[model samples]
Target: MPAITAENQLALPRIERPGPESRPRPAWLVTTARTQLEGEGFQVRRPFPGLEVGIADPFLLLDHIGAVEYAPGEAKGAPWHPHRGFETVTYMIDGALEHHDSTGGGGYIADGATQWMTAGAGILHDEVPPAWLVQKGGLFHGVQLWVNLPASMKWSPPRYQDIGARAVTLLASFDGGALVRLIAGELGGHRGPGVTFTPITLAHVTLAPGTRLETPWRRDFNALVYALNGRGRAGEERRPFGEGQLVVFGNGDHLVVEADELQDARSPNLDVLVLGGRPIREPVVFHGPFVMNSREEIVQAIRDYHAGRMGHIPPTRMDFSHLVGEHIDQDRGGTRR
Candidate 1:
């Protein structure tokens, strides 16, 4: 991956609403995330699979991985695992992670990179710290999202989109006081690089104090904002939010976000993730990494994994792009090629 240089910024046209839009006053839906030990002892804040289960339908879980510093050789990443019926999106803000999967696909996504893995049918994979990072330990921070696939598409062929930092669309703020990196869905009429089985809006936003953002969205999509750092106010009421807090919003045609404070040295910045998608409203039965609509399908997934139906990747280093279908070009700018 290349360094995310200033050259990656684009002065593209902003997304416009065709007509009058309703800006719903966002009422707070108190949601809490429970910390769990995941991937070889790393602490993760998980919102769903708990009281928040099925809150973000078509989106099963959101795992906010560490923003914690790790000493050399102290990082322990997830080993081999099997997933079926959904996609796993890993968005890295700091450090490096190497990934290998059962489909013979493998690669590494370092700082500012993202890996979108569609585990349709079934797939085995591993996400771990790269050898170099383990040798010279540094800060490791990122988020992983579990996106559920509709039952009809659960058995579709698996795929991947390894999006580099420079490849992500960075829509500058109207006044250049903030920026939004769209990972999936459309923002400001500019689409993200990720090709999705379901419609979704995922973005990483950085804001300077007093920066305000308003973007049109699908009225039916469920919206939420997770503060990665600093504090800010959002919506018509200007409800305040802080780091690590998740804010669920009422239905609306647009999202309103504003930054009100500077990030201190103890915090990173006013970085927040805006995620929303039309609810699938399907039966969700989860067993470990497998998410399916029925117990029968879950059984089949386990059998498929144990029977070696989902391919395998060797324990050593390898690149298996040959198994990936049509290539996705990495355009370095506001829109992906």
Candidate 2:
């Protein structure tokens, strides 16, 4: 899905309102980054819709675990849980996470890998540190995004896409100062590896100091940029966003980003994940793990889970000694593959 590109140099034009005559640059709305605990026990920063901030349609939630070193036996993950009417996309920057689902689909996503699970109708799953990693201490870092499914596709068949690090498409700048990994949808002109039921764009971007890039996007889609490391700016105001910060854009067909030149040489670049999608604009009823158009559908989902309709996961022996050192990349640095 490579699109046409001119010189790598880019600039952000003045804001223009979207109308029949012109499509303006989207402005930075607000930043909503907060720390919270999820699943069994893991601290993460969340910035996706709430009482203060409106939900970025199609993207229900985004939980980012920037980078955390885990001591042996200190890491915990999501226990067996049920989900419906949405998909869970897990992109691992470092460390390893073993996922087992009721559909008998189980696997491990190591550094730079991604696991996209569609809990269409319903499914039970558990995301836990690998048995081997739990036994031996290591670092754990990643983000889990919850994507909303339209009412029509809410009951579709559950599916999964285990995208290896190498499967992702990478685009580079002319000077090699910036790299963009397309996870879903097209970035620049390059197509991403994973696909979504609804139209959306998901990309991991890394920019060296003073690097600038503009990503084309749908004018109707809602968008946001999440800073994973270092600092950066977006839009005309050049609103600064730092690690664990989320910057939501107003409306525009292009996303402008520039890496800040900080004094610290250790983090010489900025790492960010850009996400956007055409707003479903449909009624949303979210109840815990279930997301439906109406309260009735949410109740039905709870009933379905309790009725054991979503298959069951088979038990496996706890001995993971034989699997140590498999499918892992020791150097988990860098933005993504």
Q: How many backbone clashes are present in model 2?
A: 4
Model 2 TM-score (2 dp): 0.84
> What tens-digit string does per-residue lDDT give for candidate 2 at 226-279?
888888888867888778778778776677778897725646678889888887
lDDT of 1 by residue, 195-231 (tens): 8988898999877777777777777788888887788
Q: Indicate the worst ten consecutive residues by lDDT in candidate 2.
A: 328-337
Write down the worst ten-residue block by lDDT for model 1. 328-337
- Write down the lDDT that model 1 would get: 0.75
Q: What is the C-alpha RMSD of each candidate to the true structure, in Å?
A: 7.7, 8.2
Candidate 1 TM-score over all chains jointly: 0.87
Among the numbered candidates, top lDDT falls to 1
Clash totals, every prediction: 1, 4
